[model samples]
Target chain A: MTATLSRIELMRGLVGMLRDEAVVAGIGNTNFDLYAAGHRSQNFYMLGSMGLAFPIALGVALAQPRRRVIGIEGDGSLLMNLGCLATIAMVAPANLTLVVMDNGVYEITGGQPTASAQRCDFVEVARATGIAHSAWAQDTSDFVRLVQAALERTGPSLIGARIERGPAIAQPPRDPAQIRDRFMQAMGSRKGFGA
Target chain B: MPSDSAWAGVVLAALRKHDVRLAVYVPDKVLIPLIDGVHADPFFTAFTATREEEGVGICAGAWMGGLRSILMMQTSGFGNVPNALASLAVAYQIPVVMLVSERGSLGEVNVGQVWSSRVVAPVCDALGIPHQTIERLEDLAFVVDRSIVQAHATQTPVVLVLSPLLTGGKVFAA
Candidate 1:
């Protein structure tokens, strides 16, 4: 029997998968919506920065080659640093997974239209940059399947998971500074081969 | 006399010796030799990014990932990176070492490069990012190593400017 999953459930499943395999160093963003939706992966939340998730993921992947590095990026955030996909393609780190949550707008700053709304195909851009694998998912099941597949594949991969556009969740009480410290501790661990 | 090729080797060695595992670079004529040298080194993972700001972001991420990373670009490209450096690197305390080729300085033929060159140091200063100019091969190792340390210790971007004389007084080969 096919089981349906909610967006929050899919995110939790993905985070659990990432944590189980020690595949993710951190999940970064300015949107609390991602954090509140049950993502337990270490937060590298951009805080004040709008577009830095992808490059940060690239750096982590390159640095910690033995660990799988996944970025939970927003479509709006991804668009701001779109050139990063080409850089990832050039480096071709087998450990990197870029999961872009595409909800069609900048949900955190209010429901504003993103360039993604203008029909810019992030998947095609990933392909054009020579990223060996790219996937698009429209719902929870699709996200789980595509994300699992992308994580298992080698080299740079991009997953554009279509999410519903909505208001961001209430802001968390955790201080951004504390979150940053926790992320650094997670990333600074030396158990990995490259580290 | 140090040929540009020899200087390139020196720079690459310094980076590796310092354990800089990641490098984010934008294509620049003057930086081609050094970039080629970096690409050939297995000890370092090099990324050719589309813009200077993106390189900065990548370097910051690499730093958080426990890799010492440097950003390489031309002086004219600095204008493309202030926001990334300020908002991302400076604000977040992400250390990124930047190796910038001096442009619009003595013997610069490009008018656009000249205009941007004058503001490079001041901009770096304004951002509170430490910087130094390297004009000779003898100065490369020390300056680069020091900058790397400063960047990591301060958790801020540091710029190492390579003057035309240091890079060779001609356009980088195509």
Candidate 2:
């Protein structure tokens, strides 16, 4: 049933599943397509930065121990902050999920090849860093299955989903900004921002 | 009343008092005295990092491993490391105390340090991280103690910006 869906479609499906199950309380990223498509899920889009989504998700997960936090990351973005995986592993937050959409290029920056192409395999690096579960997805069906499996497991999980490079999607600015505000509001209540 | 040496003694005491057992630092001309003091203390385990951001990442990992940790670097190093602070430390809510020696301010000489140092506070503020600036040696003990307290309370990174006067005079006694 899932064979016909594209990577984008599968990602939408996974976001829907996570939201419907109430498993994920928040999602965050820098990509507009991911942010716009994730409106229903209320995902946070980090507009100004390149590689902060994973660490923000980590903080959220740690603060709300009862809730799940997912970071929708790009390969280029993840490469910029790869050391975060080791930090995540050391903390071993059970509710954190890092999903890296690997198109092997920095789409936002004019389709340049990222350092990941030559340096290392992100999933294997995650495993080596002590994250409990790490794996890659070749297509939509595999992505759905991997995400579902990761959601059920404990400890930090890194899912590298290989995606086809394409033109950037035209998205409304409102969706991304709204989600960012909502997530910040949620984080602000956690103990420190104003208190 | 504690003199400069006494203040330094209190700064050391607060570190131990807060159970900050792990420290990562990148050498800074201004931080030489404090670094030397930290090295002399057996209660603290200190490692030197190649870059400021590497120290931030290592301290984040150390914190996650049940060790309380801090990072010591210069203001110039801080300018080179927004990626580490915004992505790894802020994102993960890792309670890392960054002891930054402020440069290029009053009596400044380096042009590059002056430019980036000006943006430090605004950048930290925009990221929603907390920071305190200390210019007097007398304020060191209070600032360091509050930093440790706030870091643990929020489980987030905190910065203590030390001016040249507070960190110690730029030129060491010959």
lDDT for every model?
Answer: 0.72, 0.66
Candidate DockQ values, in order, are: 0.64, 0.13
> On residues A18-91, what C-alpha lDDT tens digit does candidate 1 reach at each position?
55232322223234555655544355666545566777777767767877777767778778877778778887
Per-prediction TM-score, please? Answer: 0.86, 0.62
Clashing pairs in 2: A55-B91, A56-B91
Q: What does the lDDT read for residue B170 in candidate 1?
A: 53
Q: After superposition, how far is residue A87 of candidate 2 from its true place, in Å?
A: 1.4
Q: Write the per-residue lDDT of candidate 1 for residues B1-174, one digit (tens) a residue.
A: 345466687788778878887767887877888888778888777768888887876787777777887789888888888888877787777778888888887667779888988878888889998889888888888888777877777777888888877877456335
- CAPRI category for model 2: incorrect
**Which candidate leads in TM-score?**
1
Q: How well is candidate 1 docked (DockQ)?
A: 0.64
